[model samples]
Target: MAIVRFVLCLMVEILVLPVTILQYVGIWDSLYKRVFPHLMCRMTTTINDKMGKVKKELFDKLPEFASSSGLTILEVGCGSGANFQFYPWDCKVICTDPNPNFQRLLESSGAKNEHVKLEKFLVASGEDLSPVASASVDAVVCTLVLCTAENVDAVLKEILRVLKPGGAFFFIEHVAADKMTWLHFIQHVIQPAWRYFGDGCYLTRDTRASLEKANFSQLNVKNIVAPLTSLIKYQIVGYAVK
Candidate 1:
């Protein structure tokens, strides 16, 4: 057991430490921004295949919650526009992400998903959505984003600020596994390296707790296990009204 543990630690150092070092020196950000969109695009098929039903159920409720003739949605952290196809036809989408490199990929996705109109892609973080007007959008969508947000509370506030009265905020995010479980232990063990490789994504964020405290007018969230890696399988899928 001692020898096995030593070997595993050595492997982690050899494989993961260099990337962590690059991140520390700020070289990783430039390289990751260019590479991540393509990687996400490649992985979209598998991800959707596993989580499509939940996403459909979440997005299908847009008309029910929205009180607009032409739905205008603001999608935060709209990486590679993975959710573009899921949106209702003719809905106008405003996309935002911290990484500017995703703009090209988002446009490409918009071309493919021409059913939904792509209004524009803004390079902005979720915590500061000053580019969007207050109470403007019919709905706000955030998928797989809260775990990586620098300030989840600030992002929630911004989401609330931009959404129209009675407009809904839809989210599908990975969250921390139950405490004291083997998966939770593994998540902690690999979190340092995961954050470096995944561009600030936290392996053990209590995002549900943050949402519950955000004081949304109506909040309905539930836990589900996604067909993803064990480290990020435990997830929450639901919407909150503001």
Candidate 2:
């Protein structure tokens, strides 16, 4: 059954490759922007809530200092402000994303999570956060974002650059499975088309390796199976301190 599904999906992808290429070249960005926020908000909220203990464990590692007024947090790719509900009261967040269309959704969600203040919204990508000062943010929080970055290393470097010394980067991301297995092969095979459809999310990204290469002061990464399909079940969760 899985093989049949894979073949069917591959056939569909082959047929749509040209149109997908057009979308990648910027044809359907507006459409994606308009639809993705709502879809993502619903999807992430449902899944994160379903994995309540896991979500709490990840957020619990955030330093208590994060709740202080002077401390600032940088949230990379804060799509529809999904993490707002998990933040501690009094934490000020600077939300950054390439899509300006998410501003309205973010604002609406921010209103509901009043304990965490929305400091600013920057129309920027993770690769270059020049508007954000070096070592200016107290901590960085990124969830399910690295795989979509054009250059994951550059994005991690920028996160490192913006974080104050002793600050931590708390993250949760879907990653490639370990070992050369059938699941790994499937992930590798469908990655290109999957990335196109998933808004540049690469299913085969070994994010744990990228995090290690970034060379944080201390790292504690754990692998877990998310409540997702086989294509994105594997995940890395934990914090890396600067």
Write model 2 residue lDDT over 86-191, tens digit each, in one string.
7776778999999888899999989999988899999999999999999888889888899899999999999999988888899989998766577887786677
Query: Looking at model 1, which ten-residue stretch has the lowest summed lDDT?
Result: 1-10
Point out where model 1 deviates above 4 Å.
Answer: 1-17
lDDT of 1 by residue, 90-166 (tens): 89999999999889988998999989899999999999999999999989999888999989999999999999998
lDDT of 1 at 17: 78
Model 1 steric clash pairs: none
TM-score list, all predictions: 0.92, 0.90
Model 2 global lDDT (CA atoms, 0 to 1) = 0.84
lDDT of 1: 0.89
Give the TM-score (vs. native) of candidate 1. Answer: 0.92
Worst 10 residues of 2 by lDDT: 62-71
